[model samples]
Target: MKYNTILFDLDGTLTDSRPGITKSAVYALESFGFTDLNPDELNFFIGPPLLDTFMQHYGFKEEKAHKAIAKFRERYNVTGVFENSAYEGIHEELRKLKEAGMTLAIATSKPHDIMLRVIERYELAPFFTAVEGSKVDDTGYRKSQILKEVFEDLHTTDLSKVLMVGDRFHDIEAANDCGIDSMGVLYGYGSREELESYHATYITENVSGLAKEILTCE
Candidate 1:
C-alpha cells in the first residue's frame, strides 16, 4: 500500500446521500413558506456545510441559515438519515483496504452523531479506525477543520502518508490545506471538471478505480 492512512469524506464519497439530503432541504425550505422547490436543484447541498448551502443558494442570512439547518436536521435525523445507502462496492473495497492493514478514518462535515448513525445503519463501522465530523451545532464544519480533528484522533502528523478520498472539490482543497494527497471519485455528485479544477492528486471514475489508485499510489 502506497498510503497507510486513508481519510474519507462521508456524504458523497462513501454513501449516496442525495435523497435524504435533498428531501431534508426541501422540507426545511417548505417550512419557511418556500414551496415548489425542486430537489434536483438542491444537489449542491450534498458535500458542503448545510448552513453555507442554505445561505449561498437561497441568499439567507446567518440566523436564517441556522434556522433552515435546524429544520433540515429535524427531518433528517428521524427519517431522512436512514434513507441513505452505501455506494455499490464500497463495503467490499473498505474490507479489502482494512484487511490490507490500511488505517481508514472518516473526516466529514456531517455532524459526528449523524455520521455514527449512518455508518451503523449501513454496517460500515467495523472498517474504520476513527470517525470525525462536525459538531451538531454546525461548529467545525469546514472540511479542513474536520480533517484536523480526524488526524488528531488518529494521532498522526505525517501528512505524506495520509490520503483523502472524496467526490468534491472541498475534499481536495482540504487535503491540499493539510499538505496531503487526495483522490477524487467521479461516480458521486461532483463533476470531473470540478475535481480536476481543484488539482486532486488522482481522479477515479468509480469505487473499484479509486481502490486501485489508493493501493497503487506512489
Candidate 2:
C-alpha cells in the first residue's frame, strides 16, 4: 500500500448526519431567539466545524456562539448523534481496507466526546485504530490540526504515506496542510464543485468506488 494510515472524516463522509444536525442547529438558533434557517442555509453548516457554523452562518458573537454550541449539544447528545447512520457499503469497504493491512483512523471536526459517542452508537468504534476529534482545547477546530494530531497518534512521521479522505474542501485543505493527497467523495453533503475547488487528488462516486481508488493510490 502507498499509505500506511488512512484518515476519514466522520460527518458527510462516512455517515448521513444531516437530519440530526439540522434539527439540533435549529433548536440552538431558536434557543437564542434567532429565526429558523432554511435547509439550504443549514447545508452551509455541514462541512465546517460547529463553532464556525454558528459565527459565520448566524453571525453570532463569540459568547453567543459558545452558548449555541452548548444548546446544540443538549439535543445532539440526547438524540442527534444517535440519529446518525453509516453510509451504505462503507462498513464493507472499511473491512476490505482493514483486511488489506491498512491502518484506519477517524479525523473529524466534531467534538471528541461526541465523536466517541457516535462511533460507539454506530458500532464503528472497533473498525478504526484511532478516533481523533476536535477538542475544546488549544488545537481549536481546524481539520488540519485534527489530522496532524491523528498522524502524531499513529506515530507516522511520513505524512506522504498517509491518505486523507472526506467530502469537503476542509478535507482537501487538511491534506494539503499535511502534504498528503486527499480523495473527495460525491456521496457526501458537499457538492462536486466544492471538492474540485480544493483540487482533490481523487473523487469517488460512492463508497465502493472510493475503496477502489484508495487501493489504487497504494
Candidate 3:
C-alpha cells in the first residue's frame, strides 16, 4: 500500500479485553445499584462508548452516567487495564509496519489516558507515531470525534489514504463519516455479518493477515 498512516482501534483490535471490560463495567453497575449486566451483556459493551452502555442498559441519566463513568475509571485505572494482553502476533506485526515506513496511530474510543496506559504497559506505544483517543473525562467518546483528533494531529491531507482498522461497526461507521477506507477484523467484538452490513472495504481474520490485506487495498 502507498499509505502513510494506519489508524488502529484499541480494545478488540489490539487486545482481547472483554473480561476486563466486563468486570469493570459490572462493578460500575453494581456501585450504582444496577444489576442487569450478565457476562454476555457486558461483553457487548467492550468496543462502544462506556457512557452509552450505562445509559442504554442502566437507564442512567447523563449526570448519573457521568458519576458511574468516574467510578468505572477508578477501578479500570487501578486494575482492569493490566487484565488485558496484546493479541498474539500483534507486537511483531506492528513493529514490522512501523519499520516499513508506515506512520501508525491509534484512534480508539477508550479514554486517552487509559489507552496510553494500556499501550505503554503492553509496550505497543513505541511502535506508533501517535495515539489519539477519546476524552479522559468521558466526553466525546464517539469514534468519529476520536478520528478527527487523530487526523488533525497528523496533519493528514488525504483522507482517502487513511485506513481505519478496528473490530466493530463503530469504527467502520466512523471511517464512513470521515470518507476513508476501513478494514474490519473478525477476531474482534463484531461479527462478520455486522461488519459486512456496514460495508467494510476489507476484512482480516487474524492479526498476521492484516499486512497482506492492507498491501492489497486501493
Candidate 4:
C-alpha cells in the first residue's frame, strides 16, 4: 500500500459519538410521541446521515425525516455535541500520521458546521488537511458525494494514494463507489461481519492497529 492521503469518517472512526447521537435520536422520537423508543436502539444513527437513518429505521418520509433531523439538531447542537469524546488513542494516532506527512482529511455524513465545532473541541483540526460533510438538512449528500467533495477539495491526483477509513458500510461502500480503497474499524459502531461483508480492503480492530496499518505502508 502506498497511501499518502487518508480520509476518515467522523463519528465512529475518530470519536465515540453514540451517547450524544442516541440521546438526540431519543429526543427526536420522543418529540414525535414515540416515547417508548430506547436511546440504545438508536445506535444505528451514528454512522450514516440522520435523514437516511431515520427514514430507513422509522419509515419517515423525506419531509418527516427532515423534521426529525431538525428535532435531532435541537438537542444535538446545544448539548448532545458536547457529550462526545474522541476514542482513546485517537489523538495520538492522528498526531503520528501527521508527523508521518500523511495528508489526512475528514469526509463524513455529519453536518459540516457541527463537525467544525467538534474538531475545535477535540483539538483535531491541525491534523486534517480538509473537511467535507453533509448540510444541516442532510438532503442530497451521501457519503459518496461528500467523499468526492473532499477528494476534489484536496485535489487528489492519484487514486492509489488515497484511503478511506471508517466503521460503517456507508463509508466503505462510498469508497468503493468512488474507486478508492477502504479500511474498516471494528472498535467503533460497526462489526467485523459488516466490514468483511463489504469486502473492505483492510480491517483493523482498534485505533493503534489502524495507525500501524497506515504507517507501515503495507
lDDT of 1: 0.88
What lDDT tens digits, residue by residue, belong to model 3 across residues 13-132?
A: 999888788888888888977766686667777888877877887788988988888888778878887889999999878877777778889999887888888999888998887798
TM-score of 3: 0.93
State TM-scores per candidate: 0.96, 0.93, 0.93, 0.96
Candidate 3 local Cα displacement, residue 17, angstroms: 1.9
Clashes found in each candidate (C-alpha, N, C closer than 3 A): 0, 1, 0, 0
Give all candidates' CA lDDT scores.
0.88, 0.83, 0.85, 0.88
lDDT of 2 by residue, 1-218 (tens): 68778899999888888888888888888888878466446866676887777888678887888888889889988988877798888888988889889999999988898788888877788889988988862124788988888978888888778889999888998899889999898888878899899989888877776666788884
Cα displacement (Å) at residue 185, model 3: 0.6
Q: TM-score of predicted model 4?
A: 0.96
- What lDDT tens digits, residue by residue, belong to model 1 across residues 91-181? 9899878877899999988888889999998988999999988886553378898889888889997889999999988999999998999
The parts of candidate 4 lying over 4 Å away from their true place are: none
Candidate rank order under lDDT: 1, 4, 3, 2
Q: Candidate 2's C-alpha lDDT?
A: 0.83
Error of 3 at 48 (Å): 1.4
Q: Distance from true position, residue 120, model 1, in Å? A: 0.7
Cα deviation of 103 in candidate 2 (Å)? 0.8
